[model samples]
Target: MDFPTMGDLADKWLEVHARVPNGFMKGRPFTQSDWQFWCTANFYRVRVGAEFVHPDDATDENPVLLNQAFVYRRAQVVAPQKTGKGPWTAAIVALEAVGPSVFAGWAEGGEVYRCSDFGCPCGWGEKSHRVPAFVYQDGEPMGMRHPSPLIQLTANSEEQVKNVYRPLSAMIRQGPLSELLLIREGFIRIVGESGDDEADRIDVVSSSARSRLGNPISFAVQDESGTYTTTNKMVEVAETQRRSAAGMGGRSLETTNAWNPVENSTAQRTFEAKSDDVFKFFRQPPAHLSYKNKRERRQIHEHVYKGSPWVDLNSIEAEAAELMQSDAAQAERFFGNRLVAGDGQWMDMPKWATKAAKRDLPFGAKVCLGFDGSDNDDFTGIRLETLDYYQFTPTYGAANRRTLWEPKAWGGRIPKDEVRAAVEEICAKYNVVRAYLDPQFWETEIDEWASKYGDKVFVKWPTNRITSMWASLERFQGDVYDKDARFRHDDDDQVKIHVANAVIRARGLDPATEKRRYFLGKLTDHQKFDYAMSSVLAHEAVCDAIAGGALEEEPDEYVYF
Candidate 1:
């Protein structure tokens, strides 16, 4: 029961068991491979791409695999579709099945070494790299102590695990490593061992967080986690895995591509949190690369795709161009290795961020209001925009742009009385030209609002159909993209979250005569984009007010009350 340095273990796997069953190296000899997680004798490093790359002292060169005490409990692996993610995860599973992957506790004073000079795996004779494993004598951290750990490959669906599991199953059955294990339906068992021997078996499960109940899994893999969401019982599975592995030193690995903001996948949460416990590795493309700047975009593509040299660049470019015809955001997420919201996004977030500010209009100032909400499971909101949103150079890179403008704000959820009072107060204080209320769950209240503020403001803007929703969304998109349009926000967190969750979709569209106009909505029903909708409504009302000559000087014949 001895082991060597992780570096050597990787070498042994490549030499003995690992193979390129498919791709350019299909049927060819195994080659050298490495993980982005760097380790030295006393330091484990996270390569956070540029500037932030640093290795901390501790968990040094002899890093433990699933060494809970010495490593992050979870690792999030994000890369394009075919950059060896499957092979790498499979390799980990293979080595974990049998290797000195376990930690041998703290080193006592002298060195502890176990030589691989006997019964080496790399077949073609003797190899130089993998050898001299360290044996545990006493008083050492027993890392990966599970000699036959129960590993599970969990995905949102069984089909998703096929890419990783199929190749993994093949590597064991077809490769020389089959001597160590046996593959069967619903189980990959250690040779000659019973189901009771939890230490040396792997299972592939899909969905159903309930299936993992009471199971003590030594390690788990969430495959293609970008699609694993709250709806698919991902949150439940994650919690279950952690609870099951609690104190037993169980660990999990997640592999996924960039997810749409609407998806709100577990991978998105992990990457965004930047938690200490979750080790993340991503080859992200540079932001601010203008679509017009083809050269910069190409360079970003080259840099992000350097890991996949075997993938044809010419083919990628061609495919990328073709994909752009449908969804450029998807093309970026896959080919450019960029973690972006999907093509259904209503607004460019980076463009939207530029308009963020901290401003409040005077209580008596002329403005328009937007109201959106639901009965439950979604937030209710009210937002105000000035009567006129003139175009200006947005706040680009903090260089004297937007010095004078006040940031717009989203009024958060409150009681019905507060909402009504706020509406009445705003109408009384400001020359409220119009109010657009999405009358879904609040039809009665909306009718009351129309009666209370009908003369001063045009208040009935129901978002029920094609004409109503499209009008608002079209004007909003223009306000976002056009430098002349003014649609700024007060940098509210709700605005960002709600907007981030919004996706552009052609709802209730006709195939033949009428061209499809997109409206902003959630990526999925569970995700809420209320604030975004309110913003759209606010913009639409402002446009209406403007069209009604709200911004024009009153004629001498016009009388005021």
Candidate 2:
């Protein structure tokens, strides 16, 4: 038998291997030496087709043959380096085109291995060459189709491996390839020396080989307790490298690619109070030295006493006393410093009593009148008082004396004309100051009063917003018991005392019924007062307005019937 030259051997090998079992030769097989010789010796004999091809013949004398050979000379085989484990790497290459004989030789040499057909006995060759033929050895294929490489590694121990691979196999058999890939890629890793138990140890060497060969391989290790202990570090590194490269071109890395510390630690500083500075949610307001430690109590007192815009007690009482005693004899009669006749009962009087016969009313005297209107059978009249009364005076001086007076005291409902006449007479007699008239009557009555009084008599529209009334009551209750303030009247002294007593009692009255009782007391008859009370109660807005300052005092002109 004659031994063939390297070129002849390569040609024969190509010829036999080209006719695959599938009838078409997608690729040809060559030994390492045959490949080298073909690449160098027949460098000019092969033709370069769209892919790679060997020409049928080559001759130096044939021009066409020379061109074809020249094309082949430029051609090169694209042999990618094996990447992963021996079995995985070999199985991937075997699926590509090299003939079964070459695969067998590679497998026997432990350089590569054939992977069995997933389920078909014809092997990958029966699958239209779409699946590469693989090298096999020792009755075991490079890779098995039923249990994946990861599953096989995990199945090392019956007790430890059973849990992981059993479920994994079930999932792979029933689930899609994408799902299987996820489970394999996500959960697989190699075992470190820390986990050397057969159940725990991972075939890291095999996994590393598969990774280097560009095979999609993953491995994971578990402890004897079946807890994952080792992970595929290469996969992590590759992913990181891929993300870094992508980010270099202004691509954003996925959130998963970002590194996060296993334990997050931070430092914080808190502010502490120094010797000079103190921390408090609220600071105390400035203190008045005289009132010093009693600042809060003093503030409450000031708010209660001086906060109102109307009815300044210090000024009004002084002015009223001075004015009433402007004429000496009239002063002697009016300010006699003793109780006399024709005096109306005073309400909200101070604790002290003094004769008004020698008292003098001062300038800028403000007298406020409170009127309680009556129905047909009730007495309709006004009560006048001075804001000039001492809020809390200890001295009982004549000029500073205070007095409250009700001029006309008729009981049964007087005619409107008669009420107007009496009001005019009282204003003329006492030189009346500001009068706040009750305006619960008909609008015509108010128009008449406004036309008559012009501005001196304030026709106050009733209201239920009783802030002023409450404020006035607060002031009166606070100041009335102070001994320095006094009340004096010549006639109807008892009535003045009664009025003062009534006011004192009423001060303690509850607000809901206070106004109604006030109106009832001022009426001519109880029956009529009851009727008027109903009307006043019905007109809550009007009553509230009067109690507030919504209505101003009218002018001081006289009114005709």
Candidate with maximal lDDT: 1
Q: Which lDDT value does model 1 have at 8?
A: 41
Supply the global lDDT for candidate 2: 0.29
What would the per-residue lDDT of candidate 2 be over residues 1-561, giving only the tens digit for each residue? 121112332233233222121112212232223233333233212222312122233244321221121222111121111101111111112211121211011123233322222322223333354434333333221222212222123211345343333333332233221111323332332121222212321222222333322223222222111111124343333333233322221110110100111111000000111112111111111222121123433442233223122224344334334644554222212212111112222232223233232244444334444455545543454444443331111111234222221223334444566555555544544433444445666456657766776653545545333454444434443343444544232223332323332321133445655652222133111112222222222223223434555346757998899
lDDT of 1 by residue, 93-184 (tens): 66556533455444453443332322224332333534333444343332322445777887877777787787777777666567655788
Q: Each model's RMSD to truth, in Å?
A: 10.6, 44.2
- Backbone clashes for every candidate come to 30, 79
Regions of candidate 2 where Cα sits further than 4 Å from its true position: 1-368, 390-411, 427-433, 455-457, 461-465, 486-491, 497-561
TM-scores for every predicted model: 0.57, 0.23
Instruction: Provide the overall lDDT of each model, using Cα atoms, as 2-decimal numbers.
Output: 0.62, 0.29
The best candidate in terms of TM-score: 1
